[model samples]
Target: MLNSSFDTASPSSMSNMSGRWDFGGEKEPLMHRIHAYPAKFPAFITQKAVAHARERGVEVKRIADVFCGCGTTALEAKRLNTDFWGCDINPVATLIARVKRNDYQKTRLEHYLADILRSYARRHRLHYSPYLKDDRLNYWFDEGTILELSRVKAAIDTVPEGKYHDFFLCAFSNILKPTSKWLTKSIKPQVDPDKKPVDVLPAFEGQVALMIKALNEVSEQPGKPTKKAASIIVTGNILEMDFAEPMVDLIVTSPPYVTSYEYADLHQLSSLWLGYTDDYRKLRTGTMGSLYHDSDFNRDIKNLNATGYGIVFQLYDVDRRKAKATARYFADLLKTVRQCVKLLNPGGMLLFVIGNTEYKGVKIDNADYLLSCLVDEGFCEIESTKRAISSKILTPYRDARGKFTTDTTSRKVYAEEFVVTGRC
Candidate 1:
C-alpha cells in the first residue's frame, strides 16, 4: 500500500525479492521434479503454508491447490498425512498431478514396464496414426522420433485404463522434450536443428526407474498418508465449478500470471502425444490471464474493481491489448477468489503465492489486487510478505514475448513473490 496506492511502487529490479518469506526445510523429494512445469514453486512452500496455518490454530484436514500445477500441494498433503482436493484447466497438468498423488506398487510398475517393453519391441512402425500428420508435431519432432514415440504411446495404451496406464503415459510424456527436436529446458518450444535425441523406449525405461525411486522414497517415509487420505483431482476451471459446500481447510497456490506463459503452448508436445488435443490453443480457452479472450473491454470495464480499474487504465494508456488481458485476468481472479471463499471452511485460510509484473512500464499489481479482493469478500487476518525463489531450473527473467530466459536485457521476473494469507 505505497502512498495509499499500489501503482506508486515500482517493480523490483533485484535478483532477490525482499529476502523475507524465503523459507524451505530439508531437501525436496524426487517426485516433485519428475516433470518440468512452468513457474512451479519450491515444494517446501506447501509444508510451510500448512505449518503456518496450524500454528495459527487452523486444523488442516484437507489441503487444496486451486491452480494445482504439477501437484506440489497434493503430494505434500499426503506427506503430511492429510486429504487433498485440487483442480486445473489443463489436462496435461492434471495428468501429472494425479500420477504424483497416487501410491503405486513397485511390483505392478515393474510388471507393466516389462509388458510395455515387450510391446515396444514387437511394434513395427509400418503404419502411422492419421494424427501423426499434425504440422506442429512435425515441426518439433524428427520423423523417426515421432514414429517411435507413437509406438511407445501405443504400448503404454495396452496397459489397461487406470493409474498404471496414466503412469506409463506420464513417463512417455516427460520424455517427449528430451526425445524430440524441441530445444532443451525452454519455455518457448522450437526445433533444435543440430540435436540428436534419445530413443523413446530407453528414455521411457529411465523415466520409470526414476519414478520408482521416487515412489520408494515416499513409501519409506514414516508419516505418509493412509488409505483414508484421499486426493480428489479434477480437470476444469475453478470459476466454472460448483461448490455447494466448504470442502478444504487450507488453500495454498500460486495463481495464474498476468499475460505470462500460455500453459497450452508449453505443454503442446505432451498434450498432442497424449491425444488430449490436436490443437493446444483450445486448451487455453477460459484460462485466467490468457491473452485469447473474446471480450469487449468497454462492456467489461464497468465491473472492474478499484485496483483493477486503476492498473488497467494505466496499462490502456500504454498498450490496449495488455490492458484488456490485465482486465480479464483481474475479473477472472476476483471471481476465482469468490469461488475459493466458497470452497474454504469457515475459519479456514487461503494463502496465495502471487507476484507482480510490469507491461510497458505500467505495474500489474496482482498481489495488491488479490489483497483488495480478499478484503471485499470479508476475509480477516490478512497478511503478505515477499518470498525469494531459489532453484537451478528457474530464472527470474523473461523475454518480451513472455518466454523464460536469462537475458538480463529482458524484463526481469520478480526474484521474489508475495505469500498473501487471509482467513475466510
Candidate 2:
C-alpha cells in the first residue's frame, strides 16, 4: 500500500543546487530575526516548498505547522495571505511566533515605547521582589543587572493589555540573555562567569526598534496584509491537540531532533522572565526526546521504519538507557505523524525538514526513517531533497558520546539535512 520512489543522486549531484535551497546562507529575512531560536529552518525553505506545491496544482488555502517552532511556517503562510494555524509546547516559542505575526500600527508602537521608557526612567531605585526568586536566576545575573531588568518589567507592566503588551514583553524577553551571564553564542545554557552583562534598558530599547522595523516591513508587503490571513499561534503539545477533521491544506514543519537540544533548558531565561513557568525543569517532561524519564521503552513502535530501530539497537550496546530513550523518541514522532495525517486533506502535502545525527557511535538515519514512516502511513508519493547546512543556530559538532560540544576537534554531525515531502 506504499508507493515509494528513490533518488540515488550522489553528493556531487546536489552541489549545483540553488542557494535558496541551502540553509547555510548568511541572508535571513528581517522578520525571522526576532529571536535566536535554536534549530529554526530558513524561510526560503518554506517559500520553495510552497512554490513546488503550486506547481503541482495544489491550491493553498489553510496551512498548519504542528511543531511550529517560533512560527517560521506560520509567518511564511501569513506573507502569502493564507490562513495559518500552528502550535508548540514551548510557551516562549509560541509567544515569539504570535508577536511576529501581529500587524501592529507603527505609530502606536512608537507611542508605547516612549511611555515605557518614561516610566522606566522615573524609577530610581527599583526593587527585585516581583522577579522570579530562583537560585538559577541569581546565578545567571548579578544583583544590579537583576534590579535593572526588574525596572524594565515594571515599565512593561504599565502598557495596557493587548498586543502592545505582548509586543513590549517580547522585546524585554529578547534582552534577557544579552543582559545576563549566559553564553551569547552557545546553544546550551552555559554561563560565562567572567562575561560582563549589558545594560537591560539599552538592549531592550535596541531590540524594540528592530522589532518595529520588522513589523513595518511586513505591513508594507504586497497583496493582502498578514493580519487579514487569520493566523493563530497557540501553546499546546502537538501529540495531545485535536485538529478535529481533515481541514488543513498543507503541513510544513521541522520537528525537534532526537535528544539534541533541551528546549526547556535552552529557554529557561525566557520562561522565568516571561512567567510562563516557575519551574523550568518541570517543563522538560512534556517535551519529546526528554531524558528526564526512566520508564521502560515502548516495545511496539508500529510505524517506525527499520533504520530507526536499527540505530536504537546499535546505541543499546553503548548505553541501554540512551537506546531506550531513542526508541521512545521515534515512537512519539510516529504518533505525531499519524495525527498530522488525520488533519491533512486529500492530496495535501507534508513537508518535513529533518537532519540525521549520531547517537553514541551509531548514525541515526532520521530522513530515511521519516520517509519510510510516511510511506507506511499511506502517503502516495514521496520525494526528498538534501542541502548542506553551512551554519545554523544549533551546534553542528558533538562529542563521541553524542553530547553537544564546543571543541573544534569534536566529531561533526548534522552538516546536511533533508527536506522530505509526501503527498496524501
The best candidate in terms of lDDT:
1
Using all chains and alpha carbons, the TM-scores for the candidates as numbered come to 0.92, 0.91
Query: lDDT of all predictions, in order shown?
Result: 0.83, 0.79
Show model 1 residue runs off by greater than 4 Å.
1-20, 125-127, 224-227, 391-397, 403-410
Instruction: For model 1, name the residue pairs that clash.
Output: none
Residues 220-297 of candidate 1 have per-residue lDDT tens digits of 987644465888999999989999899999999999897787888889989988989879989989888778887678
Give the per-residue lDDT of model 2 (tens digit) for 1-424.
Answer: 2222244542223223344467433355598998888888888777778887777777778898888888888888887888888999998898888898877988999998999989989886666555646788888988888888888888998999879999998888888889999887676677788888888878998999899888877777767552577888888888887767887878889988877788999899889887888889978876887777554666633334676777787877878777877787887778888988988999998888888876545777777777767767888667767777876438766765445678655545777788777788
Q: Show the lowest summed lDDT stretch of 10 residues, model 1.
A: 1-10
Q: How many backbone overlaps does candidate 2 show?
A: 0
lDDT (Cα) of model 1: 0.83
